[model samples]
Target: MNVNGGRPQLSGTFGAVSSTHWLPSAAAMAVLEKGGNAFDAAAAAGFVLQVVEPHFNGLGGEVPIVSYRASTDRVQVVCGQGPTPASATADSIRRLGLNQIPGSGLLPAVVPGAFGAWMRLLAEHGTLPLADVLDHAIGYAENGFPLLTGAADAIEVMAPLFETEWLESGRVYLPDGRPPAAGSRFRNPALAQTYKRLLREATAAGGGHQAQLAAAEDAFYRGFVAEAIDSFVSTTEVLDSTGRRNKGFLTGQDMADWRATVEESAQVRYGNCTVHKPGPWSQSPVFLQQLALLDGFDLRRMGLDSAEYIHTVAECAKLAFADREAWYGDPDHGDVPLGTLLSAAYTEERRRLVEAKAASVLRPGSPDGRAPHIPEQVPDVLPPSRDHWMNQIRNGLPTVVRAAEARTDTCTIVVADRFGNMVAAVPSGGWLKSSPVVPGTGLSLGTRAQTMTLEQGHLNSFGPGRRPRTTLSPSLVLRDGKPVLAFGTPGGDRQDQWTLGFFLAVTEFGLDLQSATETLAFHTDHFAASFTPHEAHPRKLVVERDCDPGVVEELRTRGHEVELVPEQSLGKVCAVGVDRERDLLLAAASPRGRQSYAAAR
Candidate 1:
């Protein structure tokens, strides 16, 4: 390891894998050693992450994938985000006497999409069988893996609720009527059995690889998994963040009706590289927008970690994210104006908004002469005391609190193989603390619907069969028409900010992959967040504690409400890149959480 506690960068010609956890990184490398391609390895790693990092992701969550296929010389997005139930309308939610969706429980459940997305990626691009890719995850879930400290604390916080309300969750998380201790061996036999049954159903079809994959998808959506979720939601009324017990709106038909789709990526050209991100349905294009705005600036001269660089980036991020709140939504449901938002004229106009000092307001630009509309900001009604389980749930995985908050963010996976395939995926939601686990499946539904607004006429208003604008964004960068880097981080609403800083550090500052991943980062919460009870803190900037005191004082002098946090508390960025000039592959993982790791041959 380096003196700064970060691992040494790994370089090779064979393959590389980086993720937020060590088990999945190693498992992905194991798949690559077995001659599977990047897609196969990523699928394997994704499943392992679900089992090992249950606090960050599960089978019932969502994942938005951006991949570059060497064969086709194409980059495409696999949209794994599920839509709201057909009956979950704004009026219906209002009838429940709630102003905003709860941050936890069944009422916010969306159709589980992560399993289908993984199956789709494997079926299309992978050279390995489904059974081969799934065996490692099954082994971990059946046998056991050492429980993480973060996971242990989450279970302990929710222990009271488990013993009283969500009994099924208690049965799985509290195996002996108590929360398991950190570093102790823990197993989820129910989840293991769930995957076992999926495989059994797949193989029973007795066909080729594609047929078996199709069978597995059917088992999860139109079959037993769907049935289990429907039965539980239909019959159960569990307590939620609203201080009321309510049944969910999801149905078996919703699962049967939805399937992950493959769409073209929204991209922007920055110098020699072309960066690709998921479409407007995600908060992805905000990254591209920031790149567009920064293309006019001379960041290299600003100097890395200088007050000027940090202020410029944070200011640009505020404007870009302001547009995200005002205009981004599911394009299939309404107009997103993405083409105009990324146009040169709009970018140039928006770039002029960044000043020498931080601006203390949300300012979304007009694209194509359209007026911008923003939802009403809701103030956070935090519990009177931290003893409430709802308080813990709000601070749990998939949610990023403000300064000095818990470290329960999300998870990321980036993989590359010698075959030239590259993949970046952010798999999150369906956290253990987000909802109660289904009895037999040992998995819970995601609260992604809470990210959507209930206000009518908003771009991201709640509606039937609409994908909520999610914070999960992955990035793939290509140089000279070939994939060179796959990178992303796990920060709710701040994903783009952290990843953009990493990309610039590597591209402009000439830092190696490891150095870029380990660099100190800063972000601003200047716009309304995408999580429940959307709140904003105008002009607030958070920097790592290790930042130069001179720079901190300079930022404070320039109108930024600067707050300092531990050096490693900001970003959990992971990256894998190809050095075509050297004919080598490189990988790096953040040392922030001490859990992220990178593996290479």
Candidate 2:
């Protein structure tokens, strides 16, 4: 819906924020408009998201950000990825008789790092006072803004996912136990107070941004923040039932021990542009593999919207992701050969296997691991249909759609300013149960317990002081020796699919940022190991209301199970680009969710 009607006018002076929710984007861009630099805008945006996108980023969850400092030409990768307490190891859990992980247990929550990550950005990159940057979030929290449609939908979806106490969620969500109807104002004085406290804490650091950041991180993880959380979690029955000693590691040591920094980038050539992503630990390398696999194709002759082109892409994506699922994980814990996977020689071999006519049975072609013997085919599950005449499956089978919704994920935002400072951030985490805000501090600890595996020997197995392996990867791409595109989407497994589609739409097919953002999207569910995609494909592809149905049918005939979703169906994705020749910044933000905004000074 160009319901935002027209993009705000652009000037040489530019600033913007892209996120799943509109309000946060607006908050960040507004900060930029008022002279705050990229770091200031991001911190402001992060706080606002904690309110508007509460389900995605409460004080409880962690954040991992990749930022590039233009002046120094150095890229700093902040891990802010959370760690399980020094106490709760997979070996510790195994001492008990229970062999399987409980679906809703609290034993796995790790130390969340989002707040600390924000603190560090302010320390290293920002010039403005932390309190000043946080002012907008505090006001929004205390004064209440009208509920946007997106917020309302997220709440309705969250009802079945969170525990009863969460019905309150302080004030960002429902105060009276009902999600605000669209357009209702919502304010949580509790959250407002929390923001105010952080501002003071930042000010007390009494040194440059670095000292202030260190202090802020300490305030949350190692100091008063951890103590308060430990107390609140102690009162919760979920903790007792999960059979954990105390809340996993929502403590100071976990935070104190935590270190978020950028890893080395995997460099791959994408035609004229050079592709870069932090490797092995991140699945971003898969994008490079897919593009490389398709390098031999005559994309220009395939016609941008034709079925043949879509078929090859769908098949190529499945092939790339099939490799991802079998190989990707924490490199320190797993044996993912990051360098070999991106090698041109390897990708070229994989591409030769793709038959020009028939759909190949999808499978993991590369040997990234030492698991087994034969090459195997990955199965494709049929997408579900809401209009199916048969309500129940044969013999009373339960629906996969219902099963998958139990695993909703959030979105990613990537912004590059004219000054060349940039950020790649993914925001996520939600629970049907309440994550207690450590008592007096009122900060809810993140429930990262499920991210770990119950098996003691698996690389990603649960462990004390180890960060759970996550699917939250946001990547950056540079064309012709300059950063041109920053893109990502939110869906545990669907991330690769959406990102792949958007990239081809822009780089190979020449679509504008808006068209690429609005283009058809689908994913192979291999990562989740279940066929439940956010939207079933072949039968489903999120398209604008104006897209032709015949086009949808053609996609289905070519092996894409197609279904039509809401106009703004795909995850909200925003990107900033440069018309390198014109020296103009091009930015676009999705109107899919509430409170999204972008501004160019």
Candidate 3:
């Protein structure tokens, strides 16, 4: 199957929004049309994603954004990934008789970061009022939007568990005691009221847009919302993926103490472009590392999706991610030698490991003589396919609840306004079945704490007020000190690998955004997962089925543990680019799952 022709890349002179879902894309474009900047449009679209794609993300989730403000010609990262509760420690999990934090449950929850992070963006960078920014989301929640097939299937699979063990979740997901039908107009009046109350509180506390957004943040972290969350977590116990009931560690104090901060991005100059990503707290820098390794290779000549191209890129990803397991963590807790890691000298040495044949092992280079440190009891099991359970539903109707596992599957948005502002943000966690919904609030706490380690001295080990090294990395690219591209995807460990391919497609092959997105891609499980159980499959390469069969055979001949996935099932990527030379704005979305879309004027 040829993997190239679908809709053409979207082009315009005004603005653009490329998101994992259609409705949010439209919502963002609407904001841009109303004179909102990229930040405001992104915030508005992000809130709508919480309402429509609750199984992937929610208001109770986290958002890590990398953006370029055209006015300042600067790149910045907004860190919305909050820390674990103060009481959460290695000892805390040991007390629960668990070796690793379960993938889902209150024990794995952290302070909800999405709301606060969005507010910070609005307060600092946006032009729209809080109510105006959130109006689309609130309207959708109160009235309705068509339920996604994937979300419906997820609810169907977890409905029984919610009813029996997480009754509050059942209240929201299975209103009227049944999973909402796919394509049905699903409404969550409770979540609508929750936002309405937040807006009202903001209005009560405000004199201006920035002040009102600050008040909204206060409402979420310090006022009635905090009290409700504390009450539920302190009093209730629920079964997690580990099959044991546990109480959460999050408290009102944790919420009040936590706030999103802006950080300098990790970046690298390759060829004519500079790529920027969030710090070690996220998996962003790994993409830069991959680019550094590929600097010596002629990727354009190797050709897109060819065996040589896929093999080289996938091998480099394995090496970079290996370093992630050994070194990347919240820099607030320890020193991360990012400068040395991204140096040409270091990457050249690491690139030597990529062989003509795929290496059937995990090889992480020593950055500054630091041996890669993996936890002793990390899970090495294979995870369920991202599409496995979703396929079980019949006729787009609800299916039976059989299993509940924490997935790193998230959502992404990319926006570019006429004013030169570009934003790439990944909002994830608080998946519908991850934790019980807070009573009276259509929200669930994030299971990001599940990514932390119990092993002492590990960079990502659990501790009070320490952010987990999250997999939610977003990317922004600048050319000759000017903002140009914003891109990201939604897949657990594969987020970096997929976006790396997309970037190379643009910079190397000179494809437009849509063609770059449609180009076949490949991923690897060679490094440990960033989610619970943290499994690793040394040298395994999963390629999309649309790739040439000859290339697939050649990849196998080279010793990769090759696995073929259904076409367009690997990454739900979206991207937007500003063509300064042409004075045109460009956007594109992957056709995978038929949900991703690009909207532009």
TM, every model = 0.97, 0.82, 0.95
lDDT of 2: 0.59
Alpha carbon lDDT of each predicted model = 0.89, 0.59, 0.84
| Cα lDDT tens digits for candidate 2, 349-396 | 677766544343446655554552121222223235352212111101
Worst 10 residues of 2 by lDDT: 391-400
Candidate 1 vs candidate 2, TM-score winner: 1
What lDDT score is found at residue 176 in candidate 1?
Answer: 85
lDDT of 3 at 405: 21
**Per-residue accuracy of model 3 over 132-169 as CA lDDT, tens digit each:** 89999999999999999888878887777777888888
> How do all the candidates rank in terms of TM-score, highest first?
1, 3, 2
Pick the winner on lDDT between candidates 1 and 3.
1
Q: Worst 10-residue stretch by lDDT in candidate 1? A: 394-403
List the candidate 3 regions with Cα displacement exceeding 4 Å: 1-4, 378-408
Per-residue lDDT of 14 in model 1? 93
List pairs with backbone clashes in candidate 3.
157-401
If both were scored by lDDT, which would come out higher, candidate 1 or candidate 2? 1
